[model samples]
Target: MKKLITLAAIALFSTASFAQTTWNVDKAHSKLQFTITHLAVSDVDGIFKDFTATIVSSKPDFSDAKVSMTANTASVSTDNDQRDGHLKSPDFFDAAAFPTLTFVSTGITKTSANHYKLNGILTLHGTAKAVVFELWYRGTITNPMSKADDAGFQVTGTIKRSDFGFGSKYGSPMLSDEVVVKANGEFSKAN
Candidate 1:
């Protein structure tokens, strides 16, 4: 009987080990994007060229995670040179004074099999605000390019520009004070 109990315990421990693997954000292939209203008739989308996050998980508890991200504010690209320049000026992100937007997660909770909620503070434009993003695990695969095990996720969240002390000069009826942010990133086992 004691032998059987020991065997069961060993099996459980082995299962736990295989369930989790470390993932490092492949920043070169990941992207963080934002969209805001423009002129009340169109939408301008921009992407931060560089950003990263760390994700960890355990079986049945995807909530076990540590996420951190750093983005270059000056890398904003709207596909238009002049507009992109304006977005980096004092009237908008003011990239000169506030060079980066960063977030470090406090925790992550699995709301359901397919949905997750991440609690973190977003520091943008020199102000910090507690923010939550609804995140979904897109799935996992073996990357063809790197021939490595990897996973991907999509995270969506919204915050009032004013919440980060960014809307004063840029917000108006045409350019709404509300902005939406999205991140689509993939991570691979870190070497």
Candidate 2:
């Protein structure tokens, strides 16, 4: 009986580790981008320069993936400090109250062969909203640099700025009502 119990314990540990995999953010190969209306006209493009995400998955379908990302609010730059400051102020992001925006995937549904509906809670400005992004599987390959299996994805969505209480300084026609979010992420599967 003791020998059988010891065998069971070893089997449990081996199964747990083998059934789960962790991927570190390949930041160099990943990008988080956004676009917003400038003067309610042309789109102003910007990106977060510093951020990282850790993903754990049990299958290639990402059926059991737990993802968490952190972005430095100070890393936002739209090529103008005055405009960036205003964005970081209470008018828009209120960066002080909400230093970082984050999302955790609650469910993943396969919509088509290459498309998925990623349901997650997007927390911004101390408020949480249920957001679903249309994600497309960009396939997988072996990374030449790291020699690790790499997976790629593209997701796009939009959210209203007023929903997060950032409409005060939107100032009529100068600022837009919605913000466009685009994410292109690549992860290196840990060996």
Candidate 3:
């Protein structure tokens, strides 16, 4: 009976250790994008080309996962060169003063089978503010090319530009105060 109990304890410990997994964003297959209403009549889309993200989970369903990401402010691009340059200037993101923006998850609440409310602190324009975003765990599968487990996720949220203390000069008419954030990522499980 003592041996049976000992074996059971060992199995539980092993399973707990094996459950912890780390996933790195596959940059080649991931994109971080945003959209803002321009002149209150049109929408302008942009993307951050240089960024990195990681996820750590101890459950296969990722119910208790922790996520973090960093993006270079100067990497903001809207396809148009002149507009991109202005975005990096002091009038907007001020890439010269604040070189990077980051987000670190503080909590996660499951809303459905594959959807969750992700709460985190987003630091941008030298200000840090708590934000909540919708997270959708697309699912996991074995990648044919990498021959490893891969997971997909989509995150969407809306943040006020004034919340971060940037772009105050431009009102809603010229540049909408609300910015729509969207990101899609394919993460590769690290060995």
Say which candidate scores most in lDDT.
3
* Colliding pairs, model 2: none
Off by over 4 Å in 1: 1-21, 58-61
Per-residue accuracy of model 3 over 28-61 as CA lDDT, tens digit each: 9999999999998999999999999999998888
Show model 2 residue runs off by greater than 4 Å: 1-18
Q: Which 10-residue window in model 1 sums to the lowest lDDT?
A: 56-65
Q: Which candidate number has the best TM-score?
A: 3
Model 3: residue 73 alpha-carbon error in angstroms: 0.7
TM-score of 1: 0.84
Q: Which residue ranges in model 3 land beyond 4 Å of their true spot?
A: 1-5, 8-18
- lDDT per residue as tens, model 1, 1-191: 99999999999989987676568888887889988987787777889886667776654345576678888889989899998898899877899999988998888888988678989999998889899999888777888888887888888998899887785876567687778889988888776
Return the TM-score for candidate 2, rounded to 2 decimals. Answer: 0.85
The Cα local distance difference test for each model comes to 0.82, 0.80, 0.96
lDDT for position 80 in model 1: 94
TM-score of each: 0.84, 0.85, 0.94
Residue 172, model 1: Cα distance from true site in angstroms: 2.9
In angstroms, the error of model 2 at 5 is 14
Clashes of each: 0, 0, 0
